[model samples]
Target: MNTDESNNKGNIICGRCAYDANPRGATHCQKCGTPLVIASVPNSDPSPASDSTLLVGGISVVATVLFFAIGGYFFWQQVRVASTPSNLNNSADNISSDIRLYNSMKEVPKVPEGTFNYGGAVVFAPLRNSLHKAINQVYPKFGLRFTEPKYNNPGQNTGITMLLDGELSFAQSSKPLEDTHYSKAKERGFSLQQVAIGIDGFLLFTHPDVSIPGLAVEQVKDIFKGKITNWNQVGGPDLAITAFAFNPKFGSSLNILLGPELDQLSPKVQFMRDYTDGVRKVSSIRGALGIGSTGAILGQKSIRPLAIAHGNSKSYVPPFTDDGKQVNATALRDGTYPLTRRLFIVIRRDGTIDEAAGVAYTNLLLSQEGQQYIEKAGFVPIRN
Candidate 1:
């Protein structure tokens, strides 16, 4: 066997013997009489196996390029659509529509055409002067007029009494109707209904000379309940605490401020005729303290509102802002303010023109336009 023979050129090699001297076209080895295998040439035409592999690889490469190209094209289309002026305008229009939806006031119900007498809590005087006047200007046919009790001062209790005595078509109240009101109304062969349309809060205020920053809710209750008699008891100067409040018979402001246990007010507690009277009295006395509506006492120069803390919490929230120029409406709406209540419209549900007028007025106050006026009049709108 020729073991050292080189088959560098295109020649055959024996499969069974170490022979490489077979001719290019031979099928058998000359030295061993065994089968011969042909060697492949470089740069010649490819075989079927090589062709099949190349075909599959080519298809894969083409498919990958096409996939990337299609994806890129769709992404470019999306970006183009998003940045177009028409789409931008559509987005702006959607935002405007959303705002309009929030402040829409298109469906205010109608009232009967006649002069109606309505009056109630002096706390609602601002709303009556502003929102009521605006309502008249907007709907001139609804002739809503504010009236007061001729014999006594106008207040929540007086207004409800007048309503029960057929002196008023409707009344505005700062507090909810109690069971006693329902009982009285039933005795009169008519029932009273109240619709809450605004949010209000009670604020404890004192003379400008008093330097106490705030008080705990329990401390306030105790002061009004005659348990705490000296200003020094609740972190103030050593002065006799003289508390002033509206008579509970005239209005429920005191009830809402001091809770239901108001039977034992301080011996020094003086009942004022109204909030204005309380303000005047408190401003004159050295150690005078008073509680009134946040809307009423917000901007008073003679007296200043005090911050209040709830339970054992030390964080005190003032009813006014830091500058003392505006009410802290966020706190009132979120219930962070310790003393908050609702303002209501009291209407007799006796199926008369008074009922129609009352329902219509309540609807107006709860409507979007009316709520705007309510907020303008320094009360939190019940709607928004």
Candidate 2:
């Protein structure tokens, strides 16, 4: 064998025959015709270059994974913070403010810059005195004003009539709006809307000296209807029951208490000029009973309120508390008292200054501060 030929770079060797010196690109050995195998170049190691490439690729993959993991952790933290109770509460408050659509006296909407005449039932006197003064103090630049009826007694019916006649910008009422009131406002080229702002109830009252158990609602109704004329019929002395009530024509108490039966009152039921007059008469006359505003009757020592049961049910709820001095606001608010009713603010929807004034007044009354005033006035606030 020639050593120089075997040492050539392009030489092929026959591994089966153990022969060298095969020509370049030969597939078999020439001497024995055995299959040839190509030999690799001498001293050419690739481990350093291949290992460096692998390391670089591994580092790139790890860096990419870490970057994504860090970004994901920060994103999760942000989501957790956004769902916290304080943030959720802020979102809920924003939604509530958007839905309320009304403002309190402190944040009152734009109102007409002039005096506005307003009046209502005598039961609202205390509320008006407190609420109106606060309104004036909060909105002095708005020039809002309130006044009573100039020509007659302030009452539910009177205030509504005056509002239809354009004598008042708004009115307060202890009774629900009637069909006749709607018709009258329609005849005057406008519609009347009543917004409930508080809860009230009618109180069955008598002289402090009258001693008797509580009466059923039906028995009280029968007494007022002249069906039961004797106090003995309702577990009292054998004295004749003289039922006195306010005139339904002027006051809304009978209308609210008796509903459509306002005209069914017995001829024996004497009509008083006002609640004060009714209280005075009942306190002075023996065996005399009358119905008046719970708000007005509370804290009156001369007269006593009776516990009233619903129909024949034995659960008698008194208009006053157990001590008989303060009003049973809980019962009235929960409708446990059989004589509960709502008080409203009547507004004219004629797109005039009166409407703006009335809406502003209603918004103020429906505010939290205004409801506090209502509670202070001895009436149950409609809002929590």
Candidate 3:
């Protein structure tokens, strides 16, 4: 029988005695007084030496050591980066002095007339777009007009900075304020704050080719890191499973939901280029698994939403209120669903008009009217 076919077969090769035997489950080798340990996958039958394996293994070892050296060089670069105050933060001198010099002339501030320049993540488009549309309809009586927002994808830090440095009057974001961003504004002598416009539920998604109704939390994690690369690994159809995620260049809500399941298997993961690519790969390949924020995936009929099975934690559940009025949501109050996260708007300490626009936009979004629009746009409201 093949060595792998035997459940407990092990081989220990001893340089001292040429002792090669199935030494599995033994405290010591039966034939020699050597400790027995499970070894890497080995050749079962006697075979000619593989020159390629010899060359490749030697190169691989040297490459690994060299790779770490390169990693150390990058680590040093990052440390230098982390230590230096970024232009957006700490370096007050970098921001235009006009920022500090602009006096708030109005005792009770009036909303600016003319088009207010705005930028935000793509995830906020539905809510923000609808709210902006409505704002123009009603707020025109108040002499307010908003330009259609220019935007970047969610969690893009640099884009936000670029938009703000220009004529942009306001900005929006789905992530929270960070120390660096705040430092930049404070250096500019600006006050900043963000609001929770609304809440969203991240859905555990699978290719429609996957027929399983749901996955346990751990199982979902196992699927994407390439560990459980077969449908049978997750109680589904017989198919090769490949976990798909967008490069973090795009914020991956999947990374947040998978959590320790990913962090624990740090060295095991291989990633693809982008989220759009992830979706495409999963849909084209049978039994592939992928995930995206509910905001991103909602209303895409081609994908399947998998209800998660999370044991009681924080009364959190999946598929919580599509409306925003419940004390306990079906998803959170119960342990039935799996993926969830809170997306927030961020601002710097400067509280520039950009922050003002975000705050204004959030106020409109959190209003009773806003929640209604959220559902219409296909997102679960945090409250309802």
Candidate 4:
């Protein structure tokens, strides 16, 4: 070997098996066959082979650092988005505030100045009276008036018929329009639209002489079905239980309370066409029991509302609660009390709505002031 080459070969050392150093130009240890490298020379430039290997390793390191940096940035962005607050609750609050403001200012008038005709369910008699009083008190100058509801015996069917026949401008119902009513109205080229105005809970009443404190839903069904013939069977006096009800075909509070069971009512249940007669029958007969709207039963001292349990539970809940002598408004509204029913104002779908008088009266019932009258008359106001 040349002298220069010999000097280069003398510089290499093996890191592994250090007992023997390799020749400076050798790539591996002579004794252990481990890879060897020359110690760095202070003033000399490295050979091209060493420079190429170091450049490839440096590039690999830079690429790995860039990949990690990009991954971390995307992960942080996703977390930031997930942590942001939502405005959904805020939007709901703003909407409620706007409604309150509109109601307070009377900024929007639902009806224009004009007279209108209306009729419907007899159950809405108290509500009609309240609406009449509200109009006289609040909008007396609007020249709007509602005729006392008529054709109210079997009120729902009667009112729907009247409205379709053009005898009434608008109708009120304690129940939604029945399928038969809809079909009849469609035949007459009109559709019925019902707007909810308030809520009423149907209450069961018994003569003061009857001593049962409360009853479960099933027990009530059994009593009306004549399975429990005597009051004693359901925890009352030994007298027979005389069940009074409206006509099976009539749409009344009793029909609502009984639901499909109305069709299955005991043949013994005496049917009346008028609720007033039913109430009187219940009061005069010592063993008589009846059901009617809470509003309708409020003032009669001869009968009392009986508490009802949910399903077969032992809990007894009254349809109405009074603090000493005043009605508990909150109790009626929260729906904790069962047997609640919705009352609706029915209008023609074919442009017959009284934009000024009809719409206004409807809106009045929905307003805060109007709801007060509804409550005063022994019905629960519809919640917004």
Candidate 5:
């Protein structure tokens, strides 16, 4: 090889073919014809930030922290509100200022500040009188005032009608709402609900001057039907028996208590406007016999209840067992009492009780203290 040729064949080697050295300034491997690349050091210079860019980054971090803090605060507030107990029905020890003390810890139902009217079976007048005093004693701040209860010259039927007609805030019923009345209520877009307050029994009573003890169930049926015109037929005086009762339109309990026997009663039987009137009539008439609630008759010294016979039984029982001192609560509850009836406080089904005086009154009657009033009113309490 010549000197210039040997100088040209330097130490460079073709990476692709691993061939012998190539000449200087060559861009590719000569033997394989492959392109070549040379490695170089990377630049370390960074891009500079502007003033606006720094401001935006700082604001983003602050906003993220603030959003998390605000979300946490709202979640805590919701938990606090949810954890707080309702003030309306809290226990006595935890009562709020807005709630008033009742017979116990149970908050007295707060009613609207207004006078409410009530009417119903005249027989329940004693119960009303008793409740009027008890409610006032327990919850004076309830703000509901009641006018004198009106007998309305009838019984449950009149009271229920008046209640549905919006003339009364509540009605005290001797019986449950009839199917006809229920349908009538449905037509008006509401329904009736009842709270049984107490139990009452129909009393076959007469003026104290009469000497007769009691009558059998069959005898009473016959007397009211005009089948037996004279008292002598039932082992009484020669005087004619004068039957007095509530008119058929007044929803008399006798109709329900007497059952099939009421159907046998004469249509012409003398009817009174109210139980008090019936009682008054019997007091004056010598041979008059009338029926009313045992609670009502027990109050009148002039009236006396008769011993009534059970169906087909040879034995007769008095209205009271303890020598006429106390009403037979057990007999009445057990259906052994022939003329037993239930008394109820009626309210509208659409939550009207929340704002009405009737709810307070019912609550009072159902309370442990309220049952005493039932006994004071001469009726059997549904609860002890």
Candidate 6:
């Protein structure tokens, strides 16, 4: 009914109470005391204050969308940072210091050449990067830019293997070239020169659960060859032995150890695939044993170093009694410890045996200052 007609009869509808109210904005209702106001339903949408609920709902949706977008961006950034280990500040600093040493070494009459790019894989060792960095900076001072190396898990001197394939100017390797590898270079109509850098050691590790008294050279080979497959055979625990060794391509220790000890590995050890897989499989095994560079086993508690020894003569000796702490470079070099290999920077002859960037870098590495980085990075220094 029309407001005017309804109001005159003293019957106004109360929207809130649904009671009949007196007409003309009465303070009290006629049928049931309730406030009277204008028409309950409006002709258009409600005013701003009255539509507050819908407005709040719209704002809430926008805020939720915005939050998700910001959250997603942060999550992606964290993943990126986690993956780039070489980009870390410490790694950069290590690179920079090596470069400085390279520059200083040139006072003895170094080459000044053009800017050129260089990089290649080195055998896995704590000092690998430092050695490379020292070389990289010096190469560039003579006008060569050393490209960052993308290290692959070791295989049989494939560091040089990559060089032959035209992937690198040189290959960094721990082991010397095999006859077959030399043949490949001969086939390519090029002579591969070996530049000796220094020596790097490999240490064997056992699970935190293992407690072997010590291991002799032959015992080590036996464990890896699958002949002695249980820790009890070596006095650790009564668990099966799962052995780990770096790939021959990236690391030469496997070949070094296998060659003299067993002549050639039983087909099982020779053909078994990749190095990373070996690390994974070995570390997870129940009573596992592993051999790797100091760099490779930094945080693993699952692997422990077993004592090694060689008698004053050629026969096997248990880890010796030194000044309480037993294993040292002497034992390793003497073959008392069993695992040892020489590391080097293998480069081609750009010039004479005396005049090349590679030769210049080799000399710098043996100097007192360059040897410091090598020592700090945790490797043996043949220089001093």
TM-score of 1: 0.69
Residue 337, candidate 2: Cα error in Å is 0.8
Flag regions of model 1 displaced more than 4 Å: 1-107
lDDT of 3 at 284: 75
| lDDT, each prediction | 0.69, 0.68, 0.47, 0.59, 0.61, 0.49
Q: Return the lDDT, model 1, position 57.
A: 15
lDDT of 2: 0.68
Per-residue lDDT of candidate 1, residues 145-181 (tens digit): 7888898877898999899888899999988776677
Considering every candidate listed, which one attains the maximal lDDT? Answer: 1
Residue 337 alpha-carbon offset, candidate 1, angstroms: 0.8
Candidates sorted by lDDT, best first: 1, 2, 5, 4, 6, 3
Q: Which residue pairs overlap in candidate 2's backbone?
A: none
Q: State how far residue 269 of model 2 sits from its true place (Å).
A: 1.6
Number of backbone collisions per candidate? 0, 0, 20, 5, 0, 16
Residue 381 lDDT (model 3): 52
For candidate 5, the TM-score is 0.67
TM-score for candidate 6, residues paired by index:
0.57
Q: List the residue pairs that clash in candidate 1.
A: none
Candidate 4 all-Cα RMSD: 27.5
Report the CA-based lDDT of candidate 5 relative to the real structure. 0.61
lDDT of candidate 4 over 1-384, digit per residue (tens): 001111232344434435233333443333322323233323344675433112111233245346546665764443333222231111211111112212421533655555666766666766666567557665565554444435345566566677778777677777866657766665765555556667777678998888776888778778777888898887788998898776645456656667787677789988766568878889898888887777877776778778878776768877666622334345556665666777876656444444234445665665667767777778876644
Q: Give the per-residue lDDT of model 3 (tens digit) for 46-68.
A: 44532212111123334544654
